[model samples]
Target: MKHGFKQRLFIVAGILLVVCAAVWLVISAISDNMRYFVSPSEIQAGIAPEGHTLRVGGLVVAGSVRRIAKGLTVRFEVTDNASTIPVVYTGILPDLFREGQGVVATGKLRADGIFVAGEVLAKHDENYMPREVQEALNKAEGAVDVGNAMRKSAGGSL
Candidate 1:
């Protein structure tokens, strides 16, 4: 009876260890794949992880979009009123991807200060701004409060 009990205990211990290991592996994998959102100001302040896939969102700077030599590649600058980051994308832009609009780009930042975007997300619905981008822009410019900004952009009274 003693021998049987000891064997059972050992089996239970092994099972528990395997379960713990699996959980740890899952958590680590999720963390490695997760992408964080940051504003242009945060990136300029060195808060974003360099060369790691992350999201930077802000308003597209007016008259900053430039076509690169008649190719699909285009360069533009995004700003949160406090700081700006140059972005390069080689694909067709969304119809709503115009100047002074909120935009989010997912990619890694280059050492030369250019954000090489793998994907660019533009405002979809009418008078819609991503919550994160709107908050960041509001924070950057105190004179332009959140309500005022939204109203001004939407061309409606708040």
Candidate 2:
């Protein structure tokens, strides 16, 4: 009976070890592949990691879109009202892509500070906007509102 109990305990221990290792591996893999969703303001603030995959959302700055002389490459700027980020993309843009509209781009930021997008997504309709872009705009507007309120309370101009 003692020998049988010892064998069962070892077997259970081995199984537990395998489970733990598997969990660890899954966590590691997820962390490695995770991409951050951020705003152009955050990128301008120097918090977003450069050369790492990131999803940035904001409005396409008016008149910022330009096609390259050669190739399908296009360059534009996305803004969160407070800051703007230049983006470079090499593929076809979405049909809804245009200035003064919401956009979300996924890619890495080069050391030169331009976002090199692997994919660019645009808002589908006039009334619809990407959640991230809306959030970023809301956050910016909130900040501006607070600033105005503070100035008023402090007897300063808006």
Candidate 3:
């Protein structure tokens, strides 16, 4: 009876260990591969990991978009008022994508600060403002308020 009980205990412990390992594997796979969206200034501020993938959204800078080799490769710039980020994509862009319009790109940041896009998404309408652009504007407004406070403290006039 003692030997049988010991064998059963070992079996239960082994099953629990395998279950734990499987759960860990699933969680790691889900979290490590997921990507988040950011903006041009956020990239400039170093908010993302250099080697990891992410999405960025902003307006395509006017006259900064160009097509090459029969549309096999395209280059463009995404910008908020604070800054702009150059992007390169090798795939066909969405029809709605154009200069002075909102766009979202999925990719990783290269060492030189350009967004190496794997996918390009364009805004669907004129009334659309990309989420990245909205966030950047909020941040900029906050900075302006802080600057105003400092200037007021110094007795400066606008």
Candidate 4:
């Protein structure tokens, strides 16, 4: 009876250990694979990871958007008033995607610094701005006097 009880206890402990290990692995995986979105200036300032997948958003640079092969593939540049990143997308772009419109793309950066976008998302209107970009712009425009240098550009207020 003592031997049987000891064996059952050992089996339970082993199962518990396995479960704990599995949970830990799952949590680690989720944390590692989670990606975030950033703007062009953020990328230029070295705020984003070099090799991880991320979303980049900005206005489609004026006169820089071109359609290739009946709207199947499009090439454009997203500019955040400071820097621009070239983007290539092989899927149907959102209807709001156009010259000087806001856009967001998700993908990894290529060796040549171009963004190879897997998905292209666009905003509905000219006034559309990401929350982070809006705040950055407001602060940069001296809407708040925080000692940060004000930056103004032709592509938009921010």
Clashes of 4: 0
**TM-score for each prediction?**
0.76, 0.75, 0.77, 0.72
lDDT of 4 by residue, 73-133 (tens): 8888887656778899998778766666666789988767788899987766444566755
Q: How many Å off is the CA of 135 in candidate 3?
A: 1.6
The runs of at least 3 residues in candidate 3 whose Cα sits more than 4 Å from the true structure, single-residue gaps closed, are 141-158
**Winner of 1 and 3 under lDDT:** 1
lDDT of each: 0.83, 0.81, 0.76, 0.71
Clashes of 3: 0
Better of 2 and 4 by lDDT: 2
Q: Write one digit per residue (lDDT tens) for candidate 1, span 114-153.
A: 9999899998864677888887887784436544544454
| RMSD of each candidate relative to the true structure | 3.9, 8.0, 8.7, 5.4
Clashes of each: 0, 0, 0, 0
Worst 10 residues of 1 by lDDT: 149-158
Per residue, candidate 2 scores C-alpha lDDT tens digits across 73-109 of 9999987777889999999999978777678999999
Model 2 segments more than 4 A misplaced = 1-10, 141-158
In model 2, state the lDDT of residue 106. Answer: 94
Q: Between the candidate structures 1 and 2, which one is better when assessed by lDDT? A: 1
